[model samples]
Target: MKVVRFICRILLGLVFIFSGFVKGIDPMGSAIKFGEYFSAFHLSFLGNFSLLFSVLLASAEFIIGIALLLGLRMKIASWAVFLFMSFFTLLTLILALTNPVSDCGCFGDAIKLTNWQTFLKNVILMVPVMVVFLERNKFSVRYKPLGEWVTLGILFTGILLVIRYCYFYLPIMDFLPYRTGTNIPKAMEIPEGAPQDEYKTILYYQKDGVTKEFTLENYPWQDSTWKWVDTKTVLIKKGYQPPIHDFRFTDQEGNDITDLVLYDTRYVFLLISPNVQKANTAGIMQAKSLADLCHGGNCAFYALTASPFSEIRNFTEKNNPGFPFYHADETTLQTMIRSNPGLMLIKDGTIIAKWSYREFPEVERLKNDILGYAVTYYREKRESLTKTILILTLLLTLAVIKILQLNFDRRD
Candidate 1:
């Protein structure tokens, strides 16, 4: 029983930690999911607070996981975990039945689960949840309340800082289809053997002042007495879909330039803004300067947005941003980058690099040679090193705290 309890606790802790970390790293993505839920349930009034709810939920999950893994404050942590799991399990059950949102966004974009899959996952997790809850009292090790609270306070603060950094910049780890190194065209390809969607075609017809629904097999096409009212095609089963299915680029004149951009061998600088009206003006100006720099070199530049043509015209008239604005899906742009105005560098159809508005490369920095390989290589290397260091520092700090806690308890 004791071994079972230990394994259950560890398993639950790791699952919670992973779930929290993924959502925390991409809080905006979670917020968007929350908005979808609110809209679906007619509770859209709370849409403004989605981000706050997202951060708080993620933080609570992380804190509970840490407490469980480190065997700290078991009484309270166990209760919290039990309640949290119970609530979400019930919620997922409802979602599975209703099928409002396609993906629950429980693991952010790191993992995608269908409504039924999410409910099943929650149901399976209940076994460990019950085990931990039942053994909560047995693992209730006494500790100095002040010290425990202080440690949690510090940890929570660090989590908030990391979330904020990712919100302003971009997620340290990109899980979207448009992540760096992805070949845009290749990601959108559909394999020849992919399964096609299965649909049930229902025909509505009226005869003798009465309407009846019939399948295509039964529908009397030869009978002139029956009049066809409408036809409904219902999807019975979904099929394989490409990751970048929604990706497209439409110019102001309603011309498709997706292939033109993807086939270009020269480096292409793309400024993506989901909403032109909400985009930062300063960031747009910076993008314009970057566009100028690209034009001077062997590169191309274009701006893609989801805003309507009227809004685009208004924005251009007001700011005079000397770059052409194309159209793409709003959600697609959001998936590409978190920032209001983000920059992407693509070469030969591959996403070479991406940057949030705050980190837009300066014109002077690339004046020497805009397409120089060394410049992008070192930048990517530096950013990768920074992420590794930050993660290691946090882990080391937690390890030290756990060691000190154990040592202090031993002395007692």
Candidate 2:
């Protein structure tokens, strides 16, 4: 029983900790997910506070996991875990039944699960959390109460600093389809003979002043007296959707320039902002400066946005970005970059470099073969992320070892 309790705590604690950290690093993405939930539930009024809410939820999960893993204030931590899991379990159950939101985003973008799968995952996780809660008294602290408190305080401070840095700069890792090195044209392409959405058609007809629904197989379409009212097609089964579904660039005159831009062999700089009205002006200035930097070079510059023509025109007049303006879907722009005003460098339809407005590349940084440099920079970034993850895992492993050692020591 004691060994089982130990195993449960270790497993559940690791899951919560990892899940929390992933979502924590990309708070804006989580906030956007929150915004989606708000829209689904007709609670857009709370959208303004979404970031804070997301950060808080993620922090709580992380802190609770740390507390349990370290066996600090076990009674309180166990209770918190129980309550948290219970609330989420009920929420996922409701989500499974109603299907209001496509995903609950339990593991952020690190993993994807359907609503039913999320609910089942919650059900499975609940068993261990329940065990931890019931065996709370088994957890004992090796350090003094003050030691645990101090450690928690340090952890809290570190988390806040990391969150603040990521919020200002970009996330340390990019997990989206538009991440550096992704071939946009390739991601958007559907292969030959790919499965299409299977839908069943239903027709509504009014007969004797009564409207009745009929499937194609049993429809009374041959009868002249049956007047057609409406037709609907229901998706019986979903099909494969490309990662880049709605990516297109349109000129001011609504001419599609998607292929032209993607096929360009030279460097192409894309100034992307979902909504110009909300983007920070500081970033806009730097991006405009980049236009001048690329003018004499064989580079093509374009500002792709989802804002209306009126808004785009107004921004153009005010910013005077020395580049042409194009249009894309707002959601696609968001997925492309988290920053309100982000920059992407593309060549031959492949995204080579991406920068948040805060991290706009200076001319000095663009000093080499632009494509090769961007690829190198992306590789270095990945390596850095890998190192950070490794360091954290090592630290957590040490902590677990110490905690286990303390438990055995106490028994002796």
lDDT of each prediction vs. the true structure?
Answer: 0.86, 0.83
Worst 10 residues of 1 by lDDT: 403-412
Best by lDDT: 1
Sliding window of 10 residues with minimal summed lDDT for model 2: 403-412
Q: Which stretches of candidate 2 lie over 4 Å from their true place?
A: 364-368, 372-412
User: What is the overall TM-score of model 2 with all chains considered together?
Assistant: 0.90
List clashing residue pairs in candidate 1.
none
Model 2 lDDT tens row, 379-399: 887798689868876875566
Summed backbone clashes in each candidate are 0, 0
Which residues of candidate 1, in runs, are more than 4 Å off?
Answer: 371-399, 406-412
**How much is the lDDT of residue 159 in candidate 1?**
76
Q: Estimate, for each residue in 9-120, the C-alpha lDDT of model 1 and write its tens digit.
A: 8998889888898999899899989999999999999999999999998888888888888777778888998999999999999999999999999899999999899999
How many angstroms is residue 61 displaced in model 1 relative to the true structure, after the best TM-score fit? 1.3
lDDT of 2 at 382: 74
